[model samples]
Target chain A: MNALRNAALVAVVAVAIVLQAVVLRYVSVDGVVPNLALVLVVVVAVSRGSQFAAVFGFGAGLLLDLAPPADHVAGRWALALVVVGYLAGRVRQDARESPVASVLLVGAMSFVGTSVFALSGVLLQDGALPVDLTLRVLAISVLWDLMLAPFVVPPLLRLVDRLGSDEVAAARPVSLARTS
Target chain B: MRRRRFGQGPTHDGSRRVLGLLVLAALTVITLDARAGDGSPIDPARAAVGSLFGPVESTTAAVTRPFADAISSFRTNKSLRGDVATLAAENSRLRGEVSTDPLDRQRLAELDGLTRTAAETGYSLVGARVIAIGPVQSFTRSVTIDVGTSSGVTKNMTVLNNDGLVGRVVQATSSTATVLLIVDTESVVGARLGTNSEIGFLRGRGSIADSGRLDLELVDNAVVPSGGDVVVTWGSQNGVPYVAGIPIGRVESVVSSPRQSSRIAVIVPFVDFSALDVVGVVVPQGTTGDRPVISTPTGKADR
Candidate 1:
């Protein structure tokens, strides 16, 4: 069961990466595509807690870094997402309690993630995009992620809820039954 | 109950430690990649990931293409409507020209226009479809094509569409290669003015959203390129990265200031980098044996 759940998590992240790389290109606004993979990491963080989110974020981030057409340094996304995951996971309790908070957390973390990634680019001098353009990309991405958060977070959380229930019921029936 | 399983399973300090470890690992990887430069050890891992996900990306691109087409069509519906009259006029003119010219001559002319630079320069062209775009997180503008080393594509080969110069092949695997678009901030192409052949260097401004213009600075200060002047690639030594005489774009406007010695012209590129789909890779002359010939514009049957 644990192995199956882990596999499911990997599959979800992979699908998000693929969609971001492929499908999202068509829906881009002014050449700025939304960060679907970052949203997934936030969802994972809010639902699964810090340790799991960090590990998942690292794996997802590494995949994104190595993904084709990615000409930047290998670990830039990994570095940004690790911090994003840790921060989002720290607020997991608040996020779980209130849908609004979870959405807000996703929005906030989107900014952090985008900013971190852009800042890394500036530091490494990866691409010669001017500061204003970088900030413009940052603002647009945050808006994109913010608008996408509500649609993504709730459904994914519910799905994660259903996936967790099977394991939770088997592991600790007494506590889960009482809570329900 | 769910909270207990995850939150309480690992102590708070344990999770913090994990985060620190992951962050450190990421930093180490970044430093290693940066220091290694061209021969980075992470390249093999990157290639492995590319090969693994390349098929998935290609499949997804194929499946989602119609929807993408619909969305793009809807977005461009207004502009498309405006273009209808202009296209109609041009069509009639072309029809008149076709009737006046012999059928064979017209066909050759059409082929010549389609592969203008390649045909004129005698390059063998291998066409490929764009599979996926670069991740938005990276500021670099690049696209993955469906052809690779298997199709005789190698790094630094000039890529172009029917319109004009696209970019160059940066990395090539077995079945896919990444083309770094000419509009990327990091891209620099040696260019020459269409009129007097004044030499200049064109650098991308990296703004695909608004203007998508490139900055052209001539080596000689006195040469002033007027508006509407055309630009083409100044051939490299062996044409490894860029071939000569390929249409880049027309100079839209010139930026002249008293303090600056040389004239800076903003060129709007011929190829639309945003809407890249099918593009051709310029295969070298002698290496055309293995790959099936798509088009040999130079009138050569086989090299």
Candidate 2:
């Protein structure tokens, strides 16, 4: 199928956004909401490449940032998402044979992104996180991201393939195990 | 014969090294941030990102307002009329209970000042609507308001509603300003005991289960009067964003251990954050303005 033919991609992203704004806001299970958009971005980006993923990730994260009340300077979400999507794209490249590999990859990427957020937050604000609170939040975010990967990635992949979504669909994931 | 890795590619090792280094750097930050040090060049970056995203956030709120209203209609609609009725009933009951019983002159003066200040600043009734909250409550401590930099809102400006202080603005864009609520763990404000002149610092503790506990770092925890000690912003500092004496909450309970030099007192914020709709962004009127005074419903100054 030509990548540009499907309306499902936009639908999927819109669904993801709605879920994020409405559903997840109402139901926060242990303060951990599923990262549906991240799942989509990772799945598509891996099939595609960092360049496309980075741009889309920035835009998507910007949406999430806007969804929240603004109290700080902007662009943190953009930076976070670009890094997450691009990195996850690389991870997808590393895990072709095993679906479990993808889970682990997504989990690690999610943890990294969350950690970066927490770090930046603490630095910007004047406070510290207790061990238990930190552990709970991290555990929940990583698990949520990973759990969502299977659900969001396949649809995302199909969407990209249908929409001819930039180069992310045409390009394969890149492995980072070897040296330059 | 030498064999080459097919999909791994020539740059694979470089990517691995870079990824490893990035991971290590991230870990270092996590460690430092955990201990509460300025996490290495992180603040400027966060501020920068927050600044850039402000406009996009405001536009999104403007676009999505209708959808949000529909979604929250049930939650908000029923409560509004109910709240009005309940408040009217309570007001009638209170008026019957106490006409005037030789009120503490100081308390009377404070309440008079509060009313006067409310009338004078025109800030007493300035209203802002909550635009959006983060998808997850834990990771974020902010919400967008209709008011913005254009509305004379700026960073470090304190927000208030009927109950008292809400939170403070950390950044501002042209049409919208973001406010970080007082319950965010990172929030720090200068507060003190209302009963006595005992001063302390207020810190947010992120849990509703704790029912809005504010950590008190008191200079004189000993002098802090017991139960009836109403906590208010210690608005005495110049350039201090929060005005002195805006009511925060009363001291709920206090505990001290043998090893502890400072006692921890949990406070309940005056504002009911969950039901918040309209709020005032209290631009600290500094010493140039009249000081706000606080009074408690109960006359007790001691536990």
List candidate 2 stretches off by more than 4 Å.
A1-32, A49-87, A90-108, A119-127, A142-151, A161-180, B1-7, B10-56, B62-117, B120-125, B135-140, B208-210, B237-239, B283-303
Q: Candidate 2, residues B250-289: lDDT per residue as tens digits?
A: 7777766558777878787777665455566664222111
Which candidate should be chosen as best, given DockQ against the real structure? Answer: 1
- Work out candidate 2's RMSD over C-alphas: 12.0
Q: TM-score chain B for all models.
A: 0.80, 0.62
Docking class of 1: acceptable
Q: What is the lDDT of residue B148 in candidate 1?
A: 83
Model 1 residue B33 distance off true place after TM-score fit, in angstroms: 1.6
Interface RMSD, every prediction, one decimal place: 4.2, 7.5
Runs in model 1 deviating more than 4 A are A161-180, B1-10, B77-117, B257-260, B286-291, B297-303
Worst 10 residues of 1 chain B by lDDT: B79-88
